[model samples]
Target: MRKPTSEKNQSEIAYEVLRQKLLNREFAPGARIRYGPLGDEIGMSATPVREAIGRLASEGLIELVPQLGAVVKRPTLRDTTELYEMREAIEPYAAAKASQLISARQLKSLQSTIDTMKKLHDAMTAGKKQGQDIAVRFDKSDLKFHQTIMNAVNNQRMLTVIGDFHLLTEIIGAARHSYSIEVLEMTIADHTAIFEGLTSRDPEMTRKAMTVHIQNSRELTLSRLQDECPQ
Candidate 1:
């Protein structure tokens, strides 16, 4: 029997909300996701929320534990390494392609994200007390900036792959407590460079900027992992 269109829409809405929460690190890695409470908060029934969890589990973002139901997936050090490697290969190429193809509206959107990031950075630097809140917002904006560039390339496969990689990185980062004030500042600087390159519409310039940013991120992520799990 076919489900009602409204039911399907509710399921999708639940999925998107849950997915954003996971990607935004509102639910830390290994945190159990309870459908009932989530459904209540989102104004939906538990059934649709459960369906959403099932979808996330299939995407490797959520794990189905026997007794614990759905839990956010915890990424390993090797997972981090491989994810960065994949990003390094695909993102620079995507940025270069985007340089040639990105429309003015996309550029404007990218700039808007960067502007939001800068504001977050400023607030954090001013010693605002909500450090975690500020960090999560900054991460969300950072993801949006990269995603905007990916969208410009118009390659669905690469967009999907790279988007998941970014989300996984955020999960790992939240688990490790890896975002420091210095790191926030560095991200802003790197993104500013990438935005400038894109604005200039220079493929080589954009590609190089992206490569350098990814290398720096890889170095920081690996160093943090080593510090956390020294052998």
Candidate 2:
């Protein structure tokens, strides 16, 4: 059996686990997060679960409502727009800088992530995998791919900023479209271009590729949001 967490570690442990569930879309946008049941499910008490909920609330992943207690926050159009705007401003530049400075080890890590995404894409296209399962796994690999590039940048502040944004995007749940074969293939192609630019040490090419990828991602996110949360 697994060891139980101490009183001090319980809250932090609960927070991390719940945060990951949100990122994994296991809770999903607009899902209710009841402290009691969730605490039971996670083998923790309501006190720690409530503390965890408060932390996620501060992160904008969960909102505390009058009667509802805690619910996942669905991103509005403005929320999605502002998010991609920050991403557009930050990530492409990071990619460019990474291309110039990325070490061989970072490149290998990135390639491995990309390869995992490709396999997930193939499994998705073959109709051998369920949508949610494959999508969740693919999302993890996709995040790793971007994070590898961000790690290559060697800027602590940038990494933390973009890391928060990535979590926000995961919470937004717009990447749901990636469950489809078309979007999965498109994403793979975009990652391929970014990888090629990085491999060749071409900053301009890397920036352009990342820019295009982010633009495409933004459009897809907006389209999904429009369909789900129309005003």
Candidate 3:
């Protein structure tokens, strides 16, 4: 399906808007989300709001808490482990296959996004943004990097099944402990390696690079959590 220029109804617009905010950390994990209140927040009514929340809930972004209505989901460490495990199995394959099948046009599109990432990184460095906020700015690029790899592979089944994991990883990135400046720099390095692998279109190297990327990020995330919760 093609991206739409305009929403056909209020619910469609509402879902996209809310989903973006959720993904971007406008709504934090365990955030209490009231349907009627959300409608007011988004300048809509309960009906459309309910529909939007339902759509997100289906995607594991929010969960119905019985007595508490819909709450933004907080993933466990196990959730992160399981999620990265799946990405390990699928994303590397996606990257490998994409390397084999990625057309010149697809590579061009990816390079374009890579250029955007360069600009985004420059803006961050110029502004000297600090702390958790850095992740907020670059997390979109992180999502783009992964999504572009999937697009390059051009596999529909990979897109459909791995797509959820793509979003889940973003949530993990956003909702997990904020990365230190060191972690952020390390992330950029890992992404560069993944891009190089894809550009070379080497299946084995690409899979190894992506798996290493996931493991490093996972360890960094868990390390941050350990410092915070001490569990």
Candidate 4:
């Protein structure tokens, strides 16, 4: 029992470590994930690393190619559009429900995430460059802000589906490199509006705010992708 538990723990560690690397764009889209070297870097054995890779593959974060091992999946424009569409369908409803059901404590936590994001956005604007770590944190806080709302919905399935879409968005966003400061500021404003709606416990306002935010995100993502590869 102890040995199996230890191996499971090791695998979980490897999974989280590798997941963070992928999320941070350390392993860029379509980059091959070599188990041996990655295991070495993460100070784990190949077995656990392989286990971790399999888990990520199951999550659609990595794809296993025949005779090519595993590579980070590169999200296409269609993929982005579909994901945003799903978010548009589901998240506004979730946000509206959250506005009705979220507790004061949860609202405080959500506000904290927004505050952190605002500081990060301000720092990036001042520095004229968003460092990789700051950018990663900003992404996390952004996710947390939304996750907080979804979690408030208390539906496991909704959380799972939305979480998957969020992960895919992160992967695609990483491939686009860092977001512009203007985009970050716009995100902050959108979040503020959402927060205000939640605070007022106005379901319609919350729903509308979430809708606009997701739509803006979809447009921004499409614009960036087009800019990156103009035909």
Per-candidate TM equals 0.89, 0.90, 0.83, 0.90
Give lDDT tens digits, candidate 4, residues 63-100: 99999999998777777788899999999999999999
Best by lDDT: 4
In candidate 1, stretches whose alpha carbon ends up further than 4 angstroms from where it belongs are 1-5, 227-231
What clash pairs does model 1 have?
A: none
Candidate 1, residue 64: how far the Cα is off, in Å = 1.2
Candidate 3 wrongly placed segments (more than 4 Å): 1-8, 112-127, 227-231
Model 2 poorest ten-residue lDDT run: 170-179
For each candidate, the alpha-carbon lDDT, in order, equals 0.86, 0.86, 0.74, 0.87
Per-residue lDDT of model 3, residues 1-231, tens digit only: 986434237788788888788667887777888878777887777787788888889988789898998888777777777787888888877887777877777677666666665665665667766646666667776777777788776677788678778667667666563555566667777877877777897888888888888888778776655543322
Query: Candidate 1: how large is its RMSD?
Result: 2.8
Q: Report the lDDT of model 1 for residue 151.
A: 92
**lDDT for residue 199 in candidate 4, whole number 0-100:** 97
Candidate 2's C-alpha runs over 4 A off are: 1-8, 174-178
